[model samples]
Target: MIGVLVTFAQTGKFDRSTLAKIAGELRGPFEGMAGLRFKSFMLDEEGGQARNFYAWDDEEKARSFFTAELVEKVTGIYGAPPTIEYLDIVGFVDNSGT
Candidate 1:
């Protein structure tokens, strides 16, 4: 599995409520997405950052999804460009019973 960490530095450009609302509106499209194991939208208001963490069953699919176009689009959404990092997922636990 692969983990993708996408971070946006808000720097007072966005508030928690706005980021939450954006996450709510955008999450639906990720539901049932191919090669996606899990996705999380997170906020750190005190740190002025927003992050999206994704676990992918296929690294290629994950890489393809985060294209330059997508970066530009997300920049427009978050009011700043994001820093994306891909990591090797060495351990995972799922207790949700889905």
Candidate 2:
């Protein structure tokens, strides 16, 4: 699997509600994306940081979401640029109870 990780800095004005809005927008589109396996997000409010990890079936499928337009859509609200890292996911663990 291909993994895309993004580190974000939120706008000073963002509260929990603003974070929820950004999460909703990302989830809405990526959930329907072709070849997308799963996506998970994390936030450190005290540190003013957010991160998302997405697993995709292939590089192309992953790159589709890394475009400038999409980045703008998400980071624009924060008024900052996000740092992204793309890596090949060679292993994983899923412990969610069914």
Best by lDDT: 1
lDDT of 1: 0.91
Per-residue accuracy of model 1 over 1-98 as CA lDDT, tens digit each: 99999999965855778988998899999999999998999887777889899999978999999999999999999888999999999989898998
TM-score, prediction 2: 0.78
Q: What are the lDDT figures for the candidates, one per model? A: 0.91, 0.78
RMSD of 1: 1.4
List where candidate 2 sits over 4 angstroms from the true fold. Answer: 10-15
- Residue 9, model 2, lDDT: 76
Q: Residue 50 in model 2: shift from native, Å?
A: 1.4
Stretch of 10 with least lDDT, candidate 2: 10-19
What TM-score, over all chains together, does every model reach? 0.93, 0.78
